[model samples]
Target: MRLYTIETGFFKLDGGAMFGVVPKSLWQRTNPADERNLCTWTNRLLLIEDGNQLILVDTAIGDKQDEKFFSHYFLHGDATLDGSLAKYGFHRDDITDVILTHLHFDHCGGAIKRDGERLLPAFKNARFWSNEKHWEWAINPNPREKASFLRDNILPIQESGQLHFIKDGEPFSPNIDIRYAYGHTESMMLPQICYQGKTILYMADLLPSVGHIPLPYVMGYDVRPLTTMEERQHYWQEIVDNEYILFLEHDPINACCTLQHTEKGVRLKETFRLEDMFG
Candidate 1:
C-alpha cells in the first residue's frame, strides 16, 4: 500500500472563524493573517493506492463557482487537483473511490465538475462515499451550516448514481478504517489507515492544523463547539499513546504531524512531508 499527497490549491478564510474564540494574539503566531484578517490555508488531500483501489479523501474546492462567489475566499496557488494527480502518474478517472469527510464545499467541491450546462461527477469512475446521516444533514442543512454546504458541489453525485455510504465502524479498504466524529458536523468520517508500519489518521475538520492542537482551539463553524473540544481531548490522548501520524487537510505548510503528551497538553511533536515518512 502507498499514499500520495494531493495539493488542490490554497484559499483564504477569516482567522477568527478558523480559530473560534481563541484570540488572534494566539493563533496569529502560527497561522499569520493578512491585512483583511484572512489566513491562507491549503486544501491538502490524500490519495490511497492500495492494490486495485485508488481512493481519494476529500476533494478540494473546485473551480465551478462564479467570480462573485469566489471573491469571498481568495483562492491562490498554482497547484490543482488534476496537476497533482498528474504529478503521481494518475488522473481523476483513475480514482475508484472518493471519501468525502463531510459535505462542506471545500472538502467535497472537486468531487463534481461543470460539464457544459450540466453538473457531473469529476471522477467518472469513482464511487463518492458519504454517510447517510450526514448526507441527510447536508441536504437539509441548518441555518448556520447552510452556506458551507453548496448544492452545486453536492447533489450531482447522487444524480449521477455514484453515491455510496460507509457504514459505522466498517472497513473501507484492506488497510483503512473509518472513524466518525460529530463535533465538526454530523458523522464526519475520518479515514484511519495502517500504512508503512504506522497509523495515520485523516484530521478532516476535527483538527485542521498543528496550530489547532490546543484543546479549546475549536473552529467556530462547528455546530457543536464543546463536543469538538471533548473529541479533541479524547483523540489527542489516543494519538499520543499510539504515536499516530495525523494527515492535516487544511494546513498550508504541513502535510502530516505527530503529537506528544506535554505538560501543557498534547502538543505537536513534529511536522513533515508525507514522502519523508513512506519513501
Candidate 2:
C-alpha cells in the first residue's frame, strides 16, 4: 500500500471560531492569526493506493465558488487538488473512491465541479462515499450548519449515481476501518488505516490540529460542543494506548503526529511529515 498527502491549499477562518472557548492568548501562540483575527489553515487530503483501488479522503474547497463567496475565506495557496494528484503521477480519473468525512464546504467542495450550468462529480470514475446519516443531515441542514454544507459541494454525487455508505465499524478496505463520531457533525466518519506497521487515524475535524488535543479546545463550529469533548476523551485514550499516528487534515504546518500521555492529559509527542514515517 502507498499513501500520499494531497494538499489542495490554505484558507482563513476566524481563530475564535476554530478554537471554541480557548482564549486567543493561548491558541494564538500556536496558530497565530492575521490582522483580522483569521487563522490560516490547510485543506490537506489523503490518498491511498492499495493494489488497484485508489481512495481519496476529503476534497478541499474547489475553485467553483464565485469571487464574492470566496472573498470571505481568503483562500490563498500554491497547491491544488489536480496538481497534487499529478505530483504523484495520477489524475482525477485514477481515483476509485472518494471518502468524504463530512459535507462541509472546505472538506467536500472539490468533490464536484462547475461545468457550464451543470455541477458534476470531479472524479468522474470514482464512487463518492458518505454515510446515510451524514448524507441526510447535510442535505437537510439545520440553520447552524447550513452555510457550511453547500449544495454545490454535495447533491451532485447522489445525482450522479455514485454515492455509497459504509456503516460504523465497517471496513472500507482490508486495511481501512470506519469510525463514526457524532460530535462534529452527525456521523462524521474517520478512517482508521493500518499501514506500514502502524495504525493511522485521519483526524478529520475530530482533532483538527495538535493544538486541539486538549479536551477543552473543541471548535465552536461543532454542532455539539459537549459531545465533542466526550468524543475527544474517548478517542484520546485509544490514540495513546495504540500509539496511533494522527493524520491531521487542517493543520497549517504539521502533517502527522503521535500522542504521549502527560500529567495533564494526552499531548502531542512528535510531529513529522507522512513521508518521514513511510519513506
Candidate 3:
C-alpha cells in the first residue's frame, strides 16, 4: 500500500478559534497569526493506493461555494483536488472510495461538486464512506454545528446513491482499520492503517495538528471537550507505545508528526513529510 498527501490548499481562521483558550503568545510562536490575527491552515487529505483500490481519506473545502461564502475563510493555494490527482497520474473518476472522517464542510466539501443546476458526487464511481452515527448527527445537525454541515455538500452523496456506512469496528478495506471518537463531532471515524509493520492514524479533528497532541489543546469546536480529552489520552499512550505515525489534517506546515513521552506530557518528537518516511 502507498499513501500520498493530497494538499487541497490553505485557508485562514481566527487564531483564537483554532487555538481555543490557548494564549496568543504560545500559539503565535507556532502558527504566527497575520495582521488580522487569522492563522493559515492547510487542508491536507490523504490518498491510499492499494492495487486497483484507490481510496481518498477526505476532501478539502470544495470550490462550489459562492464568492460571499468563501470571503469568510480566505482560502488560497495553488494546489487543488483535481490538480493534485493529475500530478500523481490519476483523476477523480479513478477513486473507488472516499472515507470521510466527518461531514464538516472543510473535510468533505470536495466530495461533491456543482454540475450545472445539479449537485453530484465528484467521483461518480466512488462509494462514499461515513459512519452511521456521524451521518445521522450531520443530517440532523444541531444549531451549534449547522454552519459547518452544509446541506449542499452533504445530501448530494446520499442522493447520488453512493453513500455507505461502515460499522464502527468493521474494516473499511484490507489496508485500513477503523477507530471511532466523539469529542470533535459525533462518531468521527479515524482510519488506523497497518503498513510496513507500522501504524499510521489519521488525526482528523480529534488532533488536527501536532499542537493539539496536548490534552488541553482541544478545539473550541468540539461538542464534548472532556470526552475528547479522554480519547486523546487513550490514543496518545497507544501511539507512543507502538510508535505510530500521526497524519495531521489541518497543520499549516507539517504533514505527519510522531509523539514522544516528555517530562511534562506527550509532545511532538519529530515532524516529517509523509514522503520522507517512504524514502
Clash counts for all predictions: 0, 0, 0
Per-model TM against the reference:
0.99, 0.99, 0.98
The TM-score between candidate 2 and the true structure equals 0.99
By lDDT, the better pick of 1 and 3 is 1
Model 1 per-residue lDDT at 70: 93
User: What tens-digit string does per-residue lDDT give for candidate 3 at 31-123?
Assistant: 888999998999999999988899999999998999999999999989888888998999999999999999999999998889899988999
Q: Cα miss at 165, model 1 (Å)?
A: 1.0
Global Cα lDDT for candidate 1: 0.94
On residues 1-279, what C-alpha lDDT tens digit does candidate 2 reach at each position? 999999988999999999999999999988999899999999999999999999999998888999999999999989988899999999999999999999999899989989999999999999999998999999999999999999888888899999998876679989999998998999999999999899999999999998899999999999999999999999999999999999999999999999999999889899999999889
User: For this target, which candidate reaches the highest lDDT against the unseen true structure?
Assistant: 1
Question: Which clashing pairs does model 2 show?
Answer: none
Model 1 lDDT at residue 242:
96
lDDT-sorted candidate list, best first: 1, 2, 3
Report lDDT (Cα) of residue 234, candidate 1. Answer: 93
